[model samples]
Target: MKYMSICIISFFNLIFFSISLFIMSLYFIMNEYVIFLEWEVVSLNSLSIVMTFLFDWMSLMFMSFVLLISSLVIYYSKEYMSGDLNINRFIMLVLMFVLSMMLLIISPNLISILLGWDGLGLISYCLVIYFNNVKSYNAGMLTALMNRIGDVALLLAIAWMLNYGSWNYYYYLDYMKNDNNMMLIGGLVMLAAMTKSAQIPFSSWLPAAMAAPTPVSALVHSSTLVTAGIYLLIRFNLLLVNTWMSQLLLLISGLTMFMSGLGANFEFDLKKIIALSTLSQLGLMMMILSMGYYKLAFFHLLTHALFKALLFMCAGMIIHNMNNFQDLRLMGGLSIYMPLTSSCFNIANLALCGMPFLAGFYSKDLILEIASLSVLNMFIYYLFYFSTGLTVCYSFRLVYYSMTGELNCSSLNVLNNEGWIMLKGMLGLMFMSIIGGSMLSWLIFLTPPMICLPSLMKFMTLLVCVIGGLIGYFISKISLFFINKSLNNYMTSLFVGSMWFMPYISTYGLINYSLKIGMNTFKNFDQGWIEFIGSQNLYNKLVNFSKFNNVVMNNNLKIYLLIFILWIMILMMFLMFL
Candidate 1:
């Protein structure tokens, strides 16, 4: 009862606070007000540390969404985590995660931002390994180490920012980008964002992190932790525009988008499928953000968060009803039994694919149109629309496999949508996923973006979705693919299904190679050079020196006789000379 109280109190309080923040954001936006509150924490010999908070429409709105999702997640966790003895600890960890995200949302100072950033990494590691299994531990280690790269990059950025005598990035963001040192800082910040967001070269951690509870996935991975990097880049958007770094980011994000979408199509793990979709959406956000469309990125961020959170929650319910099985092949014809949950699942999946007038449509379609009009190359354009099609492809494939085929669960399993406790938490985000996009668009963009293109060009988004959906449906039925034909061969499936072997590369592949290199170094250097020239060589030399000394000392009588004979000979020589 006491443990449940923690969940109840935190959930209700957060709901109230989130609603309050939403109203405040509306007022703040209408007034066109941005407030900066700073408190000087310490002053020492020309160095000052100040904690800074930024309150504006953007920050307030994001914070409101975060708290909203987090509260619902907590409410949902009450049922999802009820069996665990450490439910209280889980609730507290979640609360701490929300607080850290809030800190990240409002802070303008790099020092405070680092606190929030590190808090996310640390707390996420705790949450990921909460199940106390080797799989969870491995996932946590991978998640933490991959993020640590970004942490180091950000720390370097902080150190370089010392030249301006302040850790506040806003004061110098506008003008200092041209300075060489500041450019370096911008690069570091972008790298940090890339790692945190799980962009290409660092994307192996997101799906791996599904070892955590589904509630954590709903709150942290889907909504908060992954997006922290994008939000930071949005704040630093001015520095990234028209730079080589942004150009590079655009390419990398586009590839990540393609890679994730392709990977999801070949995956069977239900949670990993959604996780890959999250990764694909992140790539979309990063792609647009890199193109200087920060507003669109943030808009998509909010909208994607709503639906993606719901998607995870619905998946959680299904997984729960199935008695913890997550394999897509092991789940079939579930829509027949769990109507409400299936509807939510289908709607969220459709939203992810940018179904017409849904939440994703408003943001994703607009991003593609704007991207098409940009002065970019055909390769970049292909990446955008092709990734969009792949998104639809994988999403449709997931829904079909999970909801339409013969029942694949165990004979004893009885599926139903009767978990009112879990449904209540999902219901909040479910409605938001439907309307959050339109409302956010109207609120965030004062003047809607004017997009003009030819008819076929305009139809490109719909065209791809249709084609991809058809392919997704037909491909799943293909005996050729299921029978391990050309495209389904061991090598090809292994490559695409494993996120292009990113998990292996980012985790054990690199690690294994590194350990081998260290072993070789030990054989070549430590054992070879140091052993020969250092201790062993010193022992040999000392042995020889000791032997010579021992001979001279032990034969002291002979030495004295030799000395006497020499002395007499000298005397005789002296007499002869006289």
Candidate 2:
């Protein structure tokens, strides 16, 4: 039975792999379809396939990473979700998520793109809430609601473009001839991207989304969903290249980076901390995108997927080892019991912390170099640098608190490294974490700049990692401070202050106040005019008046009375005129 189940799962994976390869090849073959259509050498209407080849090196690299991560998620799920009653349902959802994400990556038109965009969001919500518990339901609901805001913006932008007779991405490219319209579209696109990416106010849903299983969190949160925003911006790079919208992107991205980094510092739940770190890393990618460093942003995205997925999976192993205990406080001295798990966890953490010779080091350093260039504002560069330091602090804290501290509780039955299936997945991802940068360098146009201090900068980054880890270790070891004090304070301030203040800042405040006043005026009317009418027994009086009129209208009496009333009215009007 187990062997049969494995074969069925393998069959599904084979189908997915085949589809991915076919789409990738088709995208490459149709690379010049856009150019040919644009130059009018080929009639657009005559073309059977509406081919907009998103086959640039950066996009191809990202797509490859997406496919690789998604395949691992499926493989991991085969074992992870082995005996659940709804295992078939889970596999179906996983397949759908992969399909939607692929559609999103290759979509050439804004309208078609939204099909995949909304589809992925829906699938993710389903995946997150797959356990169907109350907490998971709440998390799914929050994700659905928050992403709706982004979807609305995206829909509006698409509507606005379509209303102006632009139905496709190519039309928008041509429409950019008008600088004003270009700026408007750019602003709307950035708004959509910001919300989808969970920048600032939109970021709340992401951490809440951690109620999902570790694999779901690993794939959706770390590898795919959040990266969608960065992908959109990069996909439409020409629109953002020289516009005020680019500045807005930089500002929002910078704030998200700093704030999420700080948030990561305070989170106690292992998954929640990783979620925040994902947010911060996404912010850095956005910041890099805004700087027009597509290659660097793509590189970072690749490296991030590798290490973040590994981290979450390692966290999963830890949780599983401890019999589903997610709190790091209760998880101490796990290294001795689960050496293989701890080793993989440490390697992933080191990569995440941007240790030298790791994937993160090269990609992050490239972003920092671009940020430091004189073209960007000084404040922006410093903000990026500060966020980088914070990244180190949180990444290592996750490592120290969970793995290396003194043994506090008796060890539970630790599962054997769960054989080759799970570990193979982790090891495959770990290999990418180590060599992703070198692979990316060959895939993309990025060449290491011939700067004298490249080595020095690498050393400094490592030093920061070491120092940051030490600080986190000491704080965790000696301080009487509560573990999640910083996070609690931050969330409290956000909910109590900012969320409350939103009503006052928006036009809704005036509208709500006006509604209250209007209701009071209606109340006054009811007390005065309506009360007078009620005192007269208006409905009853009307019935009585009709009864009296009916009696008077009886037979000849009705005719006499009508004549008399008409004469009296005529006499009065005549007298007034005279």
Candidates in order have lDDT scores of 0.91, 0.72
Candidate 1 regions with alpha-carbon error over 4 angstroms: 42-48, 479-486, 489-493, 517-578
- Positional deviation of 287 in candidate 2, in angstroms? 0.6
Q: Please give, for residues 25-119, the per-residue lDDT of candidate 1 as tens digits.
A: 99998999999998888999998767899999999999999999999999999998999999999999998998999999899888899999999
Q: Over all chains combined, what TM-score does candidate 1 have?
A: 0.90
Candidate of highest lDDT:
1
**What's each prediction's TM-score?**
0.90, 0.78
Clashes of each: 0, 0
lDDT of 2 by residue, 1-578 (tens): 65337535654564476457546644653462222222223556656434343444344446667777777766776666665767767767766776777777766567667888899889889988988899989778878877888788788778767655644665566546356655566667777777778886677778778888787888886667888888888777777775676787889889888888776666677887888889889999998888777767877887888899988888887776677778777776778767888888888888877787888877887677655543767688768877778787877677777777665545545545654566767777788788976766554542556444566654655565677777766666553275346645666457432333332333245468889888888787766677667864787789899998887767667678889999999999999999
